[model samples]
Target chain A: MENHERSIRLPDNGNKVKAMQQKLLGVAVIAIIFVAWFIAARIISKPLVLPDFVETMQQFFKGWVDSRTMSNLGITLKRVLTGSAYAVLVGTVIGLLMGYSTKVMMAVSPIVNSIRQIPIMAWVPLSIIWFGLGEGPTVFLIFMSAVFPLIINTVSGVTGIDPNYINAARSMGAGTVAIYRDVIIPGTLPSFLTGLRLAVGSGWMSVICAEFIATSKGFGFLMIEAQERMQTSKLYALMIMSAIVGFVIDQLIRLLEKRLTSWRFKNGKAVG
Target chain B: MARLSVDGVTKVFEEKGKEPHVVLENLRFDIEEGQFISLLGPSGCGKTTLLTMMGGFQAPTSGKILLDGVPVEGPSSERGYVFQNYALFPWMTVEKNVAYGMKFSSMSAKEKQEKLKRLIEIAHLQGHEKKYPIQLSGGMQQRAAVARALAGQPKVLLLDEPLGAVDFQMRELMQNELEHMVREAKITVVMVTHDVSESVFLSDRVIVLSSNKGRVVADVPIDLPRPRDRSSEEFDKYVFKLTNLVRRAFQERTDTTF
Candidate 1:
């Protein structure tokens, strides 16, 4: 090891270059997917079933994404954010209660588990009946989609804390409130973050489902309308837009996780 | 004067369908105002359990622990307990961790800062205050734990195997550093350990406990002078004596049980 020359091939100062290479790798994969899409579209030669990549991109840029599509996307985003936020808040609180108290777990677990076993998709008709069609049912479906994962994850996080933190906090003269505030919450953060990520994914999924049933506008509505009207290019464009939105939101979440949990990675990923 | 007294403390754990397990039976000791005492034993000898009881994190089933003639009801800043794992909050920086105990203290802002600074220096953690515990080495974390423990100006320091998690090479240095800090603070220290040399080296008195009922089999005092030489015959003699006593205790417990 000592015999090796310092300047020959270390690349020790090439971290930026390494990062650029990683970005290029992601771009390359996307480019390959696009190439495959173009080939399939060309081979099919039918504009109704599998629209050509060029026509879809053209429709996305000029024809399809006008004020109406933009407004629909905005509406979907709003419902996703509002409903998921409520789910996260409620789920975390309930989870903390159940996690901290065995009695709460005993009472809540059966009901929560039983409800969670039913497919989130199966809740759409019931939610419409219960809340009536419109934003109410849409938001309710999205909340249900997000809440279970949040509750389960938060419960695990709260219960999974190392007992030493509690003991140490108590010994440090911390009262009950201080212990929970300073120790329990921070100690359970990594778990909560994991749960939040799951909530976002499921919440987005619910938003799409609710849009299919309740709304006259939104990405899901556009997909159904384009299919009925035989506007395959617009349909493909909306599908692409949905994929992009979901991918962007998940990436945003990952970015948030990296920023907030930087300390965990400062070492070798030490977690609570 | 006795700073901490273990008054015939006994602890028993009862299971629903199983027999009661007596962890410690009639355990008694009086730790002086500035003495450094070590409860040395084998694994699961209830040494850590005894330390927990002294910390007031757990209550003894029968007997009581008193500090300055007052019965200890719960954990307080007056008694600093260092866990075996150090138990430093990984989320906080070293400075934040050392300042943690002081937050609950009744000290004024300036006083707390002064104490925090003093303890950081005592723990030899001057530059590493901004770094998180997870980023630190085991030995440094132990030092940070000591600084945090001393932050609230506790009259007594209770350590649960202070050097147990440290590297072999760093263990001796940490022991010496811990001893120096404890002496400078003039605080009575009660430590639990399963190491022979560790007990003999860092403690003023080593209390060896037998396993079966967690009884104190021997209380050996090493009257060796300060800066005691580890290579000296006197030090070796004390180590040998304690080691043999522990071995005999092990033998006796097994013999009695059989």
Candidate 2:
């Protein structure tokens, strides 16, 4: 009986050990990279060009405590949230419409394709011309940057749904609206979440660019001001901050995606 | 009383730049109320097409299908269909999938709950109500699909190879469960299947159809007693007879084409 229990428990114990070892290796690698970067920064000449790691860390901490810096961060975050919300709402509606009907999809395909081809930087010129140098243009640029990815992913997700699912719904006496609500929306959720993640990343890039180009406030403007003054330490600090924030946001989105697709992975075996 | 009637029903599929392909021709059958009828044939024999026509998912090219003397234009709640793929909604829990059909009905929440409870019990899914379709095994998913179809209390239940996706062991168990459900519900059933033993096991009568311009060639009544034994001499004899008929149907199609 003891041997039987040991046999049953061995695989689970082995798996747990393997998972912990992998996580430890990942952390060790990251720590090594950080130490190497610090050492290299110390040896580099001209602090203005490449500030020492200690100085950069000090500046980052100061920026965190600074009221003006905190307010600027808040402003940047607000613009990103608002613009992304609008893009998601509008893009999802259009995507659902296009996904359901071939005619609508065809009609909108060319326009979406052309829009996607143009860079978000290119939109800055047009946005400034249309809405002038203010928050409006900044928000508009962010919205434009995020919408195409959101739309495309939503449409692809909705269209990729299995025909059997829809047929099953129909046989169960579901009306068009019920089918859309109960089947189409839920079926496309994983893809929609993926699109939202892409949109968030794109929206962040656009908002920062817009703030640097046209706005008087926000982290992007602070970075530009630091660049003009040749405050390399402050600049490095801000860059690090942005990188950390983006990484955190992406990780959060990934966590959400994993939660949503848990059902897909629950079988514990890979399917072809 | 007949629950569904297929009178001279024929189906022809036409493409943009090709000759029309005839699927079914002059297919005539009547499903009496509460009767279990199986449409047994090989692939591409138009059994699925005929089943779809009965369910109102498709219309006959030349003839008509009637449900209680009224013509079927499109899908209606009166005839519930169970797909071979066990098309359970992946997003919804088993209970929610069962309740999906009743969303449009005027039944109160409590009444819907009561009905759903009964259905869960009937489908033998008493404990796994909160699990999604993807969480369950193949047999369980098919059971959930059956529960979802039966939720609306449809007059006629249409099954298109409903047990095809399961393994042999599970298939046997589901076949028995299905027969029990049919008898208990007393609802008219019309199933299309490629499995001869499955048809003989669950059906009151099995309608064998010929391929390539499909038409009913035989309507054999299954005189075997219920709760059928697959290994019994009688069951083997029937299986042999049906297999011969199916082989002959294919042979006849080939001979006519040449």
Candidate 3:
């Protein structure tokens, strides 16, 4: 009974207040971190190590569009989104294969294990050699890094479906294809979203690494150029913006996760 | 009328290098049309296995089952199975869960909608159409499972511990409600349950199984009226006889402490 109470959906006004407070809390934390950085940079650190936060902000707003920061940011976002799309599509197919067929799993397991053993960084030099230093290598790295989580998570999701649902669907005269299409796919979505969460982070990491190593554009490229030119303020600006981009992406994914999995949180505990 | 005949059914499990274990040995039973038959036994007596075989999820090692003179093949909409845990699609609302069977149904969309509405009402879940099974109470989940199972208007409904997860008072109420639903649908039911009072209260006939080799020990008939009183003398008599039968079966098995 107490659990039933705890599981009650927040009223409209209550929800508004909660959302507002959560946003405020998030901003306040970031502001405090900025203040601490301002004091530290002002007092102890060299300008090269940590630039003035206020100066970085002023330069960031002034030359934001001039330095191609926004454009580079757009390019990086595009690369990550496209690579993730391909990763999810291909990864879902591979996961379904591994999940449904033992023969496919046996044949693919060794190759997947071998690839996973190689570091994501190791793929940088190899990709540049194979595809040349352009979007090819950058996209390839992101795809490779993003796909492992997608494949592994999708496999777990598909294979982990409750047998009872399958049986129930089958008993209802649903054919094999229909069962997989309707029951298996939707039932496995929560688990797949968890994979998407991990994939986005890894995919972002790969794009940045590729940009820093070989690419002449995107956020990583901007940061590298700033470092080489001793533009500490620009580097700080890039760093702050980069963190914000990752944070916003993560927050969006989290909101999606919560939405897709409202079935789980409808009650205080996951009765299903 | 739906007549189900289970004839000389045997199920044996063969493990690697171990002696084969026979779960059921030439078990035979008959369930008449519209009868509520409860397969009652102590734990591990293969009552659930028997129920699953009836549902065509599992096949017998020997012999066959016939439904209205047709040999039972693979799973079909003609027979509905309700698991103890409800087996509801967690991602779906109660309305969708109840409406799921229509995807395979030959009925028109209008007909399906009417049936969905009626079943939801019969399950007493009028306001809960938007709620997921996880959000419901245990008894409510069982009702939703019943609603889903009855959506297709199957010849029979197989329930494996339909009320097992519900609280005690709720269990009694749900059992009565379930019997009412079954009667209203006029569907044959083969239910597996261990609760003696549950077996007595809900079934038109209760078939008790002994543990050693899954075999029916006794088949008791209840000619009691609708809404049979649990505190009544006749109900207590049935409970008493079944309790002793279960105890005797348990005593025969030296491994069991019950």
Candidate 4:
């Protein structure tokens, strides 16, 4: 009887072990891929084209340790922050105006529609002509790329707010400013954060492209210079660095989004 | 003073290319201070429309809504409205949601906290002060909504089917809580409800309304003692009479040709 009871409990323990094993299997697969790539690099005749993982990692560390590379990365981040700030400010204001008034919505909708159709890449030539080279053109491109999505999303956010909330506030004797501040702003924050995430991704793409074409600093410039000099290894290194930076920024935004939306998932997950 | 008086209130809703629909026609009523009055009717009876007009969220096409003998031209801090959907701001914590209208008041933070504590206690939401609306159950959210409206200390409180969305057991419980809150606060309450038993259980007087050109048809008074027993013979008699009145109103409307 005791043996039978142990047999029954064994399946539950087995399932727990199975779940842990699956996680370990995932890590093992990633490790295998890296090992395979490293072995292939040694076997290949054109070793420069497919540099060993060890060399690439060393270069990555070197780039990080060098003050010049760090400063260039810092400059790129600064541009993104400044461009995103301006975009969020202008976009949110315009969105609020359009959302609240039917007349303004009708008048401005066509203009926003036309502007939205123009690709971020297509604006590079005009941005360069308008603002010239250096940080200005690159930042302008990033701003132009980010602002439309932010505005559209913000307008949608404002429109999606429950009319009952507005009615409740109004009946409570809240003035216009109070309603907008207390009800409208908090109501739209989730959608606004979503827009902010999308803007960051788009802004990064535009800024990199602008940098590749015109600027002297940043990862994009370094990648282009490496390509011109036929340094594939350096080019790949810069590409990897850019990927890391993009991923880090995306993760940071996701963390913020989770924090903001935690109120909705009170029982499901612990708030970060 | 009479808490509110609607003088020949009429409301017409205009639709493009269609004839205007008259919701309320020469409907007049008065609510005395500290009285619990319920506007009971079928759906589309314009009871909610009348409530909104009284709250100053909308204006009657032709008529006047007076509060405390003063003509109500627009919404003021004196009137508090509770929505059927329990329109508590989802982003705010329960305490902050209750504190929302108080932000506009010149009361200091300490005074606001004291008032918030009182309202929370009255609504039986003492422990869930930090929770968001989404975290609370439907009954809890409604209770928090009640706390929010009472926080402003308005002259009159309007409830638009406050218990409509709750389950039957919770609805009964909420009915008792609502009645207790009204009695304790001594605030004028004008609630709209479709449930006949709920009206009888809570109201001092129930106003029955007819729909489709919605007008007040019957003004029934419930003289039962406080803490009404639903299973009692007197309660059964009142329920039967109110049911007959509603049935007659429906049949009368159906008999009319388009």
Q: Using lDDT as the measure, which candidate wins?
A: 3
Our model 2 lands, by Cα RMSD against the true structure, at 3.6
Kindly list the per-residue Cα lDDT of model 1 for residues A1-272, writing each as its tens digit.
23333442355447668989999999999999999989998998887888889988998786334988888888888888988989988998999899889999999999999999999879888887898877888888888988988899889988988888888888888988998898778777788888888898888877887788777767788778888999999888887778888889999988787766666664334333
What are the per-residue Cα lDDT tens digits for candidate 3 across B1-258?
249998888999899999998888899888899899998888988888888888888899998888896878888888998998889998888898999966688899999989998998889999888888877878778888988998877888999998888888788888888987888898889999999999899889999888867778889998788788999999999999999988776665655434
Mind giving the per-residue lDDT tens digits that candidate 3 earns over A1-272?
A: 56665656547458879999999999999899989999999897688988888899986775556647788888999999988998999888898889878899999989997887789999888889999987888888889988999889988998898888999998898998988887888877888888898998899988998999878999899889999999999888877777778888988998888877788775433323
Per-residue lDDT of candidate 4, residues A205-264 (tens digit)? 788888988688886787788788876666677778888898799999988987877776
Model 3 compared with the native: what TM-score? 0.93
Per-residue error (Å), model 3, residue A249:
1.0
TM-score of chain A of 1: 0.87
Candidate 4: list runs displaced more than 4 Å: A1-54, A260-262, A268-272, B106-110
Worst 10 residues of 3 chain B by lDDT: B249-258
Clashing pairs in 1: none
Model 1 regions more than 4 Å off: A1-26, A63-65, A267-272
DockQ of the candidate models in sequence? 0.55, 0.45, 0.60, 0.46
Docking class of 4: acceptable
**Number of backbone-clashing residue pairs for each candidate, in the order shown:** 0, 0, 0, 0
True contacts kept of each: 0.68, 0.58, 0.71, 0.64
DockQ of candidate 2 relative to the true structure: 0.45
The order of the candidates by DockQ, greatest first, is 3, 1, 4, 2
Expressed as tens digits, the lDDT of each residue in B160-238 for candidate 2 is 9999877888899889888877777788899999999998899888899988578777889999887899989999888
Task: Give a tens-digit lDDT track for model 1, residues B61-112.
Answer: 9999999989888888889989989999887889999999889888899998
Query: Candidate 3 has which clashing residue pairs, if any?
Result: none
